[model samples]
Target: MTRYWPRFNRAGFEESVAPIDYLEWYIPRLEELRAHNLSFSGMQYNWNVLDLLGDTIADIAKPYMGDVDDPKEIIAAREGVNIENVLITNGATQGINIALLTAIAKIRNKSNGKITVAVESPTYAPIPQSALILADDVIRVNRYPPKDYGHWRINYEEWSAALKKSDILMITPISNPSGWFFHKDDLAWIIDQAKISNVTIIADEAYNDAYREIDDYCSIHSVAPNSISINSLTKVYAMGHIRFGWIVSDSETIAIARRIFMTFSGVMSSPAMRIGTKVLQQSSIVDEAIADYRSKNLPKLRSVFAKHGIVWNEPLSGVFGCFELPNGIHSELFADHYCKVNDLLVVPGTMFSDSMQNWVRVAWSIDPKSFELAVDALDRSLELALNQKQVNKSK
Candidate 1:
């Protein structure tokens, strides 16, 4: 057990927000603070503290089944794919790890135990960290910069150039933290180019299954045979506690993935799998209920954000949106102090990208009253941050 992962065992790991060490150090501290906290650093929308689903999945002892109504089957059918391609996993993070590790296994011998990965920058930190651990090189193709919602394109020239060289293309479509939607047409072109270059594709579509969309977006698996799609119930479904996710790919790809998976996770969680099945069975009711909650409260939150001059892109799909910290406060510094003083949290965008040091992600997934309370707390933190900037400036 020599810790077989792609994490760099070098110095200066604490500096960047996207590195693995930062997340490992930061998350547990957040939990400890939450004894008296009201954090917005969440992925889901509209959850009640009390049990809502009534104990329906408590009796699962066997492996889950059904190419229909089963959680894996439900996701497969909804996405219009086959059950054989669906992989029921513990969480989207696990799904990502499996996808990357399986792909790495194939390239290890040929590339001398390493491969090149091209990841969309400003992505969820885990994406590149995992890739960095598994690949020889992880080239970051910066996505569209923040505050500009009109054009959310990758630099085609940069992306295509990288696609030609990379052995794997890993991306978070309708990503976490930013909720930036990669246009389906652009995705198609990328997938096609990846195919020509013989690169395997993994679309981490965890949020797409959660949020509402303006322009319909499809996962790359639908258009490419070599592509894998990952998703979960943690976000839009308000099922974070359940910790269920899955991967979808063609039979050959999934076959290899299943082999790698057996070495780690022996079997999917029966109870969570059952609950996932339950969620999918009732998806229409559940999805609409959460969407309706957002429809009611998001406008109020937007008004508050505008009043404070906090600018953000309206999320096209997920519950999270990145906001520029007013008065040029570095996001990591603001996050630490914001928690100490406010008893609440906003994830620093630096955790996703160092380039996003001036921004923080805001979540509006809680009930309106709780959201209002978080906003009120933010009201105080915002004022102090602004005033502090002036005090330092005048000195």
Candidate 2:
């Protein structure tokens, strides 16, 4: 008997599905820290926006029993895709999970070798972690460092090589830490490579909706028919409570994903789909608020970072970016110290990748005045941390 590498090995699942360390570190600081919550990577939810939904609380609650309208139809009409191509899920996380499950199922049948998944470094934790469980092997395709720090651009050679061996490439279209959207030519090149290799590109597009103004903005599934694009209201629309997201791909892929989804979740939440429909119709309100926040707060954020001698990627559209720490201080150490001493919150980049230990992710999605206070607090925290490091050296 020949020993071929097994697909979705039970022992592999045990080792691969560890806790998402970032969420573990972040949730405590997020709840306990009362002042200056810079860790808000999403637009701060505007409580009053619910009143503008054009539905009474009682009317919205009706869907808890079940929704009459098909969510796939709603999203298809909005995204200009066919109903067959859409699969509604609880959130972007579930969309990604379903996509991976589908990808592995599709690849394992065809491949003689172990299935490999390639993910970007400095990424949102779940992308790589989820990939680890579903694939036989997971490899990092660096998105930073080879390029200068803070600047994000994919190296074509590395990606092309990875695509040859990989069954799935999990990417964030607009990167989480750096907020860098792919260059048009680069994206096209990647699609071509995936097409040639028959590798699936599962794009986590949670932040893509934020930059509709950008001319190059189009869902990956639309361009690369075999690829999948997943999006949600969690980050860009400031509607995390709704738990609404969807996947766009070819009809066949969507069908496969739906089956996998049903195995895990018997049905989608009716209430979430109903509220999500209203929110989609009312998205302009959130977009306008985001624009207002950016206009009033971006300059202040830029000014404060410059004052503190901190350099950042300077995001093109979104309100967040990755910052390189001064004097090569460890980001995890500084983030913990910052929260404890100053009651502030910032995400340490170590959560994204071990290589990113010297970097931190910061967001200015709060109101202008509140953001101003947070940046000032950040400045003071930086000085104190630096001074403390110096004191330790003297001892």
Candidate 3:
């Protein structure tokens, strides 16, 4: 038998998926903990639905039962854009994937030599990971660690220079793992550079609404002609199970990306479409969900992170933040250590960026009671991690 590696930079994503989900395959050693609600690992805000709008489970149960309802109207209203500008996707990830593939197709058809995707470094892993998998070429621009929470901006000059060398820029508005969103002027600077370089900016705003209380985030779709915004119900709406998301942009990009989406599955599931549209039309439900999460969980998480000496930028608009763990502990190791010993599962920063190896992303979104329990367990876990480090050194 012959064997070949995938060549895509999916190894890190593959390795971390199972552990991050707290499944039994790799963490057989922590079977009991696996069953517990100790998750701080995932980015989704798990919340209770305030209403049951489903007419019947059977009606929307199968894909064929749901009518040909388009999410364009609802999304257009939500994003304040024209109906033709929105294309519904199965999820934000799929939206991102199709967008990338569309760009690849366009660039390849132009007979442009292999295109380069410039990803801001220390970003959501999948931005670069997916780019590398699709384009097989990526130019990374580094973002230095902020000494404190208030200063989370990256150098505009450095980022623009990297943008000049690429055909596509896959960036996150409110970063996953990090929770650090860009300032308004910095976002404008990026858009200006993209226009100058003729690079398509894929602005991922998955976590945009998480900080609505603090900063009213403006999507680049309103400001930049060359930018596309992909967002999902997975994060802020606390509706991850719906698998609903959409891309907002000009007609040309939507036409190409829509064709790519059709090639993938033709249409989204009936239940997903029905539920997704309903959710978007109803803003009160979404608002209440996030408000509940903030009121119930933020204070405890803030206390827990501070007490553990975990330094992180206060998330401007999301429930999770990339956290710098104290010295004498590594992300992958501490993530495992914290999970097994304290049932507090976290995703290590290595999953996001190579430079973030010592960091771990902790979510403020989780089952509120479980999140509280995880916070209670933090001190003991940090102490245990330190003690274990000492033992390893002695060996």
Candidate 4:
């Protein structure tokens, strides 16, 4: 496996250091500590947007259940895929789990044997954790940027070797933390290799909406017959509370995913489905808000990182990006110090990969004013840490 499960609990279940756990621990304390949250990777929620959708609320609030638009059909129409290729779920979290399970099932059904999985390093925790739990074997593939903080890409030789022995490949089109969108040539090459290797590809496209206009081809599931793409309203549309998400793939792959989903979650949330349908129809409202925030906050984010002499990945259009922390300052330790002393929250890169212990992920999805305050806090915190490092070195 790319990483081992931290340790087994008393119940004999494995636990890992995932972003969700840290967020769950930190969120309730955010307001108490008056912390400036730079860790929120999703778009800021807007109540006014919901207020304008009064009809949508009224329709979903009907006491009795009635006929409603199918979220699957809506997604199918939008993606130009057949209805059979779509499967709705609670959110991207569930979508990923179902996709992995479905991939395992398909492999087992074909060979009636064990399967190996290849996962990219510095990936979202759940992808590797789930693979470790479900697959017969697991291996890591390098997906990293050069020392100069250039565009991130995979080690082709390593990836090719891993794919030959792998039954499934898990990837994030717009990678988390790093915010590196796969280059067109790289993506096309991966698809071809997976086809030759008979490996199923599961793409987590949660951040892809930001680049939809520029690269609609980011949804690999729509182009590769053996691949599956998962996305949700949580990250892009600020509708995470609604718990709406979907998966796209070939009919056979989707059928397997549907069964896996059904086995765990009996049915889709009725209200979420109804609300999500309308949300998709009026996504432009949320899109406008996202664009506005990016326009104002992205520049500020770049400026703050440059001011502090941090090496940032510098993504063009995503809420989050990774940056290397000052020399000798561990990300986990610095992040905790930053939060407790400076009242700022930034995600430690160790949560995603052991190699990223000196990195952190910062998001610019909040209001410009709040983002400004958060970045200022980051500046003070960085200076304090660097100064401390200098004093220690002198000793």
Looking at model 4, report the run of 10 residues with the lowest lDDT sum. 1-10
TM-score of 3: 0.83
lDDT of 4 by residue, 1-395 (tens): 22222211112343533333434444555655556888877888674545545666665655324566666777898788899999998999888889999988877877558878888777776777677777767788867876866568887899999999999998888888788788777888899999999999999998888777665345888667698999999999888998999999999888888888889998877678777777887788878887888888888877877887877778767688888887768887787775559988887876677778788888988888998899888888888888888888999
Which stretches in model 2 have alpha-carbon errors above 4 Å? 1-16, 48-56, 59-70, 145-151, 387-395
Clashing residue pairs, candidate 1? 6-133
The per-prediction CA RMSD against the true structure, in angstroms, equals 4.6, 5.1, 4.9, 3.6
* Candidate 1: regions farther than 4 A off: 1-19, 32-58, 61-69, 106-113
Model 1 alpha-carbon miss at residue 390, Å: 2.7
TM-scores, one per candidate:
0.85, 0.89, 0.83, 0.89
Candidate 1 per-residue C-alpha lDDT over 279-314 given as tens digits, one digit per residue, 9 for 90 to 100: 667667656655765786678767867777777578
Q: Provide the clash count, candidate 1.
A: 1
Clashes of 3: 4
Q: In angstroms, give how far residue 242 of model 2 lies from its true place.
A: 2.8
What tens-digit string does per-residue lDDT give for candidate 3 at 1-395? 11111122445454333122212322453344543343342344433343545444456666643363567887788778888899888888887888888777777855366788888766655567678667746787766767876536778778877887789988877765577777777777788888998888888877765555565468878878877888888777766787888889888888988898898878778878767766776656657655676678788877766766666567655566666766547777776666556765666666566677787666656667766776676556777876677787899
| Whole-model Cα lDDT of every candidate shown, in order | 0.71, 0.78, 0.69, 0.79
* TM-score, predicted candidate 2 vs. hidden true structure: 0.89
RMSD (CA, Å), candidate 2 to true, equals 5.1
